[model samples]
Target: MKPNEKQVNIELTCTEIGGLWGIFIQESMNIRFLTYFMHHLQDEEIKPLTKVALEISEGRLDKIKQIFIKENFPVPRGFAEDDVNLSAPPLFHDIFSLSYIYMMNRLAMINFSYTASNNVRLDVLDFFTECIHTSTEMFGKVVKMMLSKGIYDRPPKMEYPKEIEFVQKGSFLTGIVGKKRPLNAIELSEIFFNIERNYFSVLVMLGFAQVIKDKKLKNHVIRGKTLSEQQIKFFNNLMMEEDLLGTVPVGMEVTDSTSSPFSDKLIFSMINVLNSVDISLISHAMSVSMRTDLTAQYSKIIAEVMLYSKDTFDIVVEKKWLEQPPLVTNRKKLLNSD
Candidate 1:
């Protein structure tokens, strides 16, 4: 942009459009949840953390709105105040909201990094870069809060390596049968984090199921909870096979409030989004894992999650809850118009 040269504006690429659209919808939903939690949160220390998170989401929504308006792109009808009930009794304890913010920010960092890396537009790139910075800050604050509360589930500690060592045996990757080499640090880290993620997933399904009144949606959430539980057990078994301590749940309690704080559509959409994120993370785990058995386990878990995600998508579509993304026009249909 210069005084002599006219500013030439380029239309957004498909990826740019998709990234902005997706973030808009997610941030809008986050704003609703954060607003509800702020209404009920009583812990003075955690209240500030929740407030920062809400501010971040609100800012993102406003920025995305500006971009959409500039491009004349239709804004998505994402979740709003009507989707959340501020007066509903607390469905989750204060600790759960803190943990939820921690997990959401972690996932946001991963997603924003990916989206930023793939796009070329200066505005879009800058937006995601700023997002990464804010989310990283929020994540650190939440972790500190969790640690101070003595509730953070730290990854397992290991003794220092005696020396720099290289693999000596062809059996380094073998683990499907007989005695195998002890789990490498990389494999162990992936297993630990994946199990931790599934714990959060289980908590979401468990809490959402209790408040959902629709029989079909309740059953689906329950099924998702069972799937998360099974994955956790499988990952824990892998750790035990190596004589390592397994991951323990964070014990974030869910209240028995049968009243739903969110609309059925919102609850269903939340679960749906959680499942989709789980699949992406599991796929990443598969890529980083080294041991044959660990890779195989990751593969199996991904397959299960993919199948479950499809079922969730089908239900969303059936219930008319799925939002359509921007798409290319059909040239053939245009040419054949009567």
Candidate 2:
């Protein structure tokens, strides 16, 4: 290979290696958590299922280790002595644990799918395919459990709104002045659907925050919850214009269980902060493509939410749980100029 080609091959190999290690680490940590749950589980049916999962994970772990060894690569030290707490009380109930498992399996499948597509090595491709199959099977089991429990948390059904108005094309100065072209039902539905999806992500994150114990994190979660609620209302009103329902799925129940494998406060707080930032970024992009009036209103709402987020960040910094993100020195001037 040419020098550049050799470098590229090395980089790809390193990337694939890191990805494989990540999978191993995640699976090992999950297996540890499941093993702990197995000991504390009261339900006979669930216990067996947990045991089976644990075995499958352990088998996969062994296979990965063998692959590393065969390739003369150092195996990853996943979840060493300091990484697990065997003595800690069960942090989640059977149902919750199963749901978590299901979510993780889905994540694993996605990761493996991506890796399999990218890696040209036959051995790596085969390994990722095995991982994909394992996660798929685990996901199937969890979905079956969810079905049995009758807790499929599907979003509410919605139909197209009856009354539709054409959005008139116009310049920024003359609102709806130039051409009055009616929007089709499909176009209207797509806009509302995108809004609803955004709202749903925010609400679920909020619900998770409500039960978080850390005071700083609690504030952040609550702020996120409110932000999501406002967005939901905004979308709902927009749908009302078209006479359509814009309801998003909300988790019906939340657990206040104090026991947590990780820092509940930190996890919830991080989740809220990350999700808010993501939403803000998307909203900013959306504003560019949207009508001026719609953009202005959305920006105003986002600004308010961002203020709340800033307050929460302050709390986190005060508690010393997180380092403050870098601030722009000319933020005031930038906003004023805008």
Which model scores highest in lDDT?
1
Task: Report lDDT per candidate.
Answer: 0.87, 0.59
Writing each residue's lDDT as its tens digit, candidate 2 over 222-247 gives 66666667766876766566555655
Winning model by TM-score = 1
| Sequence-dependent TM-score of model 2 | 0.55
Candidate 1 achieves a global lDDT of: 0.87
Model 1 lDDT per residue over 1-338, tens place: 66454232777899999999999989988998899899999999989889989999999999999989988999999997889988789999998988789889999999999999888877778889999999999999999999999899898888899999988887887888766788877878888988888898888888899989889888989999999999899999978877786989757669989889999878888887888888888888788776788888878888888888899889889989878999899999999999
- Per-model TM-score, in order, reads 0.96, 0.55
The residue pairs in collision within model 2 are: none
Off by over 4 Å in 1: 1-8
lDDT at position 318, candidate 2: 71
